[model samples]
Target: MHSKELLKGTLQMIILKLLADEGKMYGYEITQKVKELSDGQMVLTEGALYPTLHKLEAEGLLITEKVSMGKRIRKYYRLTETGQSSVLKKVDEFTDFISMMSRVLQIKPAL
Candidate 1:
């Protein structure tokens, strides 16, 4: 897995992009999906994940709903309307930033 320092800056954007693509997802499910999608190169720890999730919720970009499973309550998160709209801007900005950085570094754009 990459260092937290490497992942830290992009975590929120990553979460937003994932939630934007996948709709609602619970915390563990989000982590697992990330690991699966990244082929285990990025693992999100609860320490980092929960605070980001809480911050996004507090910021009104995300809303949480709790559902009781057989024995445990699971909190699922989805984008608010604002979040849904903001994600496109975030993704586009990040993409452009990456493109610019790649140009400076003389590396090919990943996508």
Candidate 2:
């Protein structure tokens, strides 16, 4: 797995992009989907997951609907209009970020 701190910085964008692409997902489902996509290179914990979800919901970027499964309620989250806008911006930002980091690190060409 990658470092927790590094993943923390990108997790929100990652989640947003995932939801933008996949529509609705619950917390554990989101985490597992990311893990699956990344081939287990990164893992998200509930300790870190819920707060981000709540923060995005608070920021008007996500909307949640609760569904009852047997005795439990599951909250599914989906991107709002704001989240869809943010996803495009974040995708550009991350693309630029990776490009800048690659340049600075001289990743492809040794000095």
**TM-score, prediction 2:** 0.94
Off by over 4 Å in 1: 109-111
lDDT of 1 by residue, 21-48 (tens): 9999999999999999999999999999
> What does candidate 2's lDDT look like per residue over 35-62, in tens digits?
8999998889998899999999999999
TM-score on alpha carbons, each prediction: 0.93, 0.94
Off by over 4 Å in 2: 109-111
Cα lDDT for residue 110, candidate 2:
52
Clashing residue pair totals per candidate (backbone < 3 A): 0, 0
Lowest lDDT 10-mer window, candidate 2? 102-111
